[model samples]
Target: MLRKKKITFVINYFYPDLAATSQLMTELTGYLQKDFTITVIAAQPGYAGENHQSKKLFEEGYVETIKVVRIKLPEVNKNSKVSRLKYISSYFFLANIALLKEKGTDVIFTISQPPVLGGLIGTIGKLLKRSKHVYSIHDFNPEQAQAVAYTNNQSVFKIAKIIDKLNCSYADQVLVVGEDMAETLRGRFEDETVPNYTVISNWTDEDAIVPIEKSEPAIRGFLETHGLKDKFIVMYSGNLGLYYDLENLIQVADKFREQPDIVFLFIGEGAVKERIQRYAAEKNLENVKFLPYQPKEFLKYSLNSADVHLVVNQKGIKGVSVPSKIYGVMAAGKPVLGVLEQGSEVQRLIFESGAGVVIEPQNYEGVIHAIHYLHSLDPGELKSMGLKGRAYLEENLTRATSINKYRQVLQAVADNSPLEHTFQPKQYKEVVHKK
Candidate 1:
């Protein structure tokens, strides 16, 4: 029996935007389109390089491949808190106006930071229209913001915590990226009546993960331009955000400047990205190179060039955060060397998959040791780790796996279908869908 659902997936950003978070949700919906009628309402200006002010807000007269409504958001520089609040309020007010024209949405989902505004708008819209609401928390807000020190200070975030807890408590379901974040949610509500919850792990496009000998120009240029063509290049590519204490890692690179064969390439942009670049330049770090971010379709080629991939983070922020890079690295089938806080999802993944080794964050000795240990591995051992990581990813983090879980959840609601059922295996060639 085919059934249609009036589902609204709300987020701060969407397609044509191309921010990491935006791409993730848009990718999720590509498969979900088969089951639900999705209406995505997002901001004009995104977290990354999408232009908002010059772009048209509503694609009013056109019915595109997907029914997405864009609301104009006044531009705000992501670096400042005051500007961010103003930006969030703009989305909040605009979405309220939008709700008046078209109301009944079965679920409302939002990514954590600036779009807490979306959560506020969805809460009001749900109550006003007598609809259900759900929050897709990519990152925890207010408190998690403080943990990363992305917020100005705790005192500045006190009032926001009150509102944030309200957003969590009011939602019908809480969807998080990792189990670590789910633990944080339980702490806030701590009460039995909390909403239904699920942890959806990160994913990477399986199709893009081809192991062709890296032929792409960017990958070749990156190696040749830096004289890294001969070196065993260990790369950490992606956003050099505040959440990562990368400047300290660069200090280690300064020490390894003599080992010019072992280069450290930091690609992508963020608040501290430029700062790290400047520090590397000031030290005249011959082994460290900074490159501009490119589109994700180009990322697989660049990622394939690395001999060993790095994921670094600040200490003590574990489970409170999950590095989205792990899944991508796994997808690329590369051995990982992660610098993360202990007792975290990153550590657990490394332990569970036997994919990578974890070095304590801020411990320059650990980083140096890991660099040497990873390089010391025989080619066969390294390949085995990579194989394990890719196998784990294929089993757990693919688009099909996530979508099936989502369908299970939604079907339970849409059909009053109970999830508590015993499983029985048929034949080895058992058919899930008999054609």
Candidate 2:
């Protein structure tokens, strides 16, 4: 019998951690635990934005007996470059200690951006300790940061690109959250053989989340008490961070300040969350309401409660990523007003599913157009779209499909899987950075 795989499941967030990324990390690790000896390395239990904290020392570094190491983060924010760098730097500092110290750590699998620095560290550990490095790219940082204007100076921007590229090319295997992200990397990398790549769209807990039933009068009663009944609830449930383009979303609510029939709700937390909250308050954008992040299982309730679900992302940045929250929104079967690059993965998904409308991120113009168009539709029509979206999700984006895809890739990599690709980076941007 094959000895169980010793895998270091890595990320900056994990269970008892409220971020969506943390939840995803926890679930995937939990699912794979019986087959592998897994240890999760992540930032310790504190999210500055949410005022969230993990109170318990992870059950001997294991969450509910699930193996995990919570490396404390220094500081982080979407807008602060120094804060962000300090955050990534913490990963480098602790990864060496928490990750490298472990003996016979057969494979080092890191989950995303905070873990990008940790990924490089994992690569270093892989060499020093004789292990394989797996870098899972959830969002492509350098380009994503630049697209969002987080780093405007070409100097700092170039450095981020260099670090990002090194993180990608240096790994033994790179797993992406979507095919589009994988293609983006394939278009940029040279020695694709050494740094192997695979795609697994992040998934929802199909088993954990039961079909939503509005059984309780308390449920409808709560909405009624809040004057939210008889309205088309358009909800965006997750973090309001670097990619959210929330200022634009607030302006969308501003445009429709009189559209009382469409109730907008934002339920979650993040670096820019307060700013979004303040704007909503200042504008007296009565259509908008805010709630804190809820547990993954609890999310299904609010998710299915929406009339038209909404997802928003700034333009030119999506090629390097596909937001996993969009998948959850899709899984809910609600029509998505996904505001993104017109031809990007999300927009294409919206079109393919025939479940929702797609809006450009051209600021006010796009938001107004989408709102007006969606509002024009009959409630019955929107519900039809929701049904179509829900069915497509059950058919295509289920958790089993997601985990299986990942297993196939991991199996291939472990088996020294061979692949064929005739594409190369036509526009080779040599990355250069400074400290």
Candidate 3:
């Protein structure tokens, strides 16, 4: 029997980690395991402050048949730059060591996490193991950092960008999660040889997170437990991070404080989370509530409890990042109140799916109006609109669809052959640019 080609995934988070990337990668690797012998190099579970018990530099384990190596990393306080630097540097150094220890790797797969270090790991693995490297860019750093003005130092940004561009150039194949991101990849090498890249959309588990009626016991219980029962819940259910403009959006919540029935629910943690929480507290925004990240198993129940979901990104994050939370919102058949840039990938999905209304980022007035407009819609109309997004997801963006594309891509790369199938984005750029 022919041995299955081995693929080593060097990523920051994995199964049991509550971060969006962790869940996505867990599902992805699970599905890919059928065809490839899989190994994952990841940091200990800490995306949601899960406790780590191991003192060893590396702890080995298995997620079914897949091998996993979890590196011991310092606890990261997202708010502190010093803490984050320690965590990133530790993961980068140890993950490189872990990758070198793997034997007979045919493909090295890594995502864009910890900025350039994630891609650098894959590039280094490919060089030492003489394997094909598949770099999946979830967010383009320096660009994403620049989008939100996270840092004002142009010199640091320039150095980071140069390093990441080199990592991309070294990869055998590059996979971007959004069409807009593919354009960003092209922009990286203007008037030069662009690396071989493909646009593959991210996905949520359709089977696992199917739409459930709010009246369902699990959904109802979650709502009641959170004091959201019968409230007009406007939920933002992912990272309360730097990119979403949540700081200003919290003020938008303050505007609705007069309406006792309206609730603005935020259900995750990030660097800016405390700042947002502090602002809400200072303003005494009783309508807004913040919760910690929910377990992966409880995601569907928590998602179904929302009336309308807020899918957003910062203004300049058009191609720099795509919020993956939108998929879960769509999967739960919830209408979206998108605060996304015009022509951005998630914005296009919302428009095409007819899932919900969209307002441009930073348009606080537009957000207020959109919220009122959605709140006024008939219950049946809202349900129907949300179902449209579910329908779109089922037809075009199912997990199986994306997993199969990945399998094909990996197989082709393993064989050192040209990709036979190229997944395109249905003329999105043309449609958006024509307007």
Strongest candidate by TM-score:
3
Q: Which lDDT value does model 3 have at 201?
A: 85
Where in model 2 is the C-alpha error above 4 Å?
A: 48-59, 75-81, 190-194, 210-218, 415-435
Top model by lDDT, which number?
Answer: 3
Q: After superposition, how far is residue 297 of candidate 1 from its true place, in Å?
A: 2.0
lDDT of 3: 0.89
Per-residue lDDT of model 1, residues 1-435, tens digit only = 755766676676777675667777788777777777677777764566655454565543212445777787776665677887787787777766665456556655555745355567667776787766666677666655676666576676887767777776776655677666767777776654555666666677877864434456777886787577877778887777777888678888876877767888777777687778889888888788777766778778777788788887777566566888887788888889999877676777777778889888888898898888888889788878877888877766686666666666555544544544211111112111100
Models 1 onward score TM values of 0.88, 0.88, 0.97
Q: Which window of ten consecutive residues has the lowest lDDT sum in model 2?
A: 426-435
Of the two candidates 2 and 3, the one with more favorable TM-score, higher being better, is 3
Tell me the deviation in Å of residue 420 in model 1: 4.1
In order of listing, the candidates' clash counts read 0, 1, 0
lDDT of all predictions: 0.70, 0.69, 0.89
Better of 1 and 3 by lDDT: 3
- Candidate 3 wrongly placed segments (more than 4 Å): 423-435
Taking the tens digit of each residue's C-alpha lDDT, what string does model 3 give over 44-156? Answer: 99888777789899999999999999999888888888998998998999999999989999999999998998999998888888988999999999899998887799999
Q: Residue 112: error of model 3 in Å?
A: 0.5
lDDT (10s digit) by residue, model 2, range 224-302: 7667787777788887776777876776777677767888888787777778889989888888888777655567777
lDDT score, candidate 3, position 417: 77
